[model samples]
Target: MRHKCRIAQLGLPADQRKALLRNLTTELIRHGQITISQARAKALRKEVERIITLAKDGSLASRRQALGYVYDKKLVHVLFAQAPERYGNRNGGYTRIIRTVNRRGDNAKMAVIELV
Candidate 1:
């Protein structure tokens, strides 16, 4: 019954899913890349792109919005400071997801999600 539903549940409750994405987004912004489950990478892509778009905006409201979602204030500041020059020419698609080998234990598909 997916119908018009688009959000991936990731088999987690709302709060946990938000927290997981928040952590992943924070680490991705901090390190510029991260390895994660394919499903999570897919989900994280949307959030990262949205946040970077906000950073690109570089408005006080947008910065506040990004700060609310991103856990690290310093990282948000850096991202906002750099986003315009780094991504000015680009419209969207701020991240790339490269499929990697399956996990050793459960065979879950893994992927490296990195900033473009």
Candidate 2:
């Protein structure tokens, strides 16, 4: 029984699942938004939030910790050096997920994950 589990697997194995979540989080941070399948967005949301929370800390260790999850070095640099300033005054709830029409290929639900 998958009782109270937090992750959204999106049918991927463990390593792939981790990579998907990490890449999506990096993209979302760089773009301030991203469009993807619903399950992916749901899975990536917590990770995105966690990184932003880390950004809020504004410590060197926190920046390095965040870099561990975000793959793009440029994007990671921007997040640590700039994003925190953009979102400095706010608390949490940095990301927003909006459901969109289902994808035509396989009828998978789609959603746009963005920052507010």
Candidate 3:
């Protein structure tokens, strides 16, 4: 019935999807904000939030865990360095997604996901 399945496949195979999300995570950490397809932004939110949560922990294990998803060592270092200071007082909701205009090529709904 397709019920209770929450992970969006994004029409890509496992490896490609993982790679896409990893790159997206790295970029978002590096740039502090990024524009992407609405569906991907929605799907990426969960992982991004989780990574931030891990970063908030500010532990070696948490850093390792974030590194697993965010491939770039430098970006991962930045994430760990900034996450706690940025979000230490807050509980969650570290990122905000704002809807934007349709993409010109495919008319896909676009959104900007930025660190809050």
Encode model 1's per-residue lDDT on 8-112: one tens digit a residue. Answer: 999999999999999999999999999999999999999999999999999999999999999999999999999999999999999999999999999999999
The lDDT for every candidate, in the order shown, is 0.97, 0.84, 0.89
Residue 71 lDDT in candidate 1: 97
> What's the count of clashing pairs in each model shown?
0, 0, 0
Order of candidate numbers by TM-score, starting with the best:
1, 3, 2
Q: What is the lDDT of residue 95 in candidate 1?
A: 98
1-116: candidate 3 lDDT, tens digit per residue: 88998788999998999899988988888888999999999988888899999989989998888878887888888778887788999988888999999999999999999989
Give me the candidate number with maximum lDDT. Answer: 1
Q: State which candidate has the highest TM-score.
A: 1
| Model 3: CA > 4 A from native | none
| Model 3 / residue 52 / CA error / Å | 0.9
TM-score of each: 0.97, 0.89, 0.92
Better of 1 and 3 by lDDT: 1
TM-score of 3: 0.92
Candidate with more favorable, higher TM-score: 2 or 3: 3
Model 1: how far residue 33 lies from native, Å: 0.7
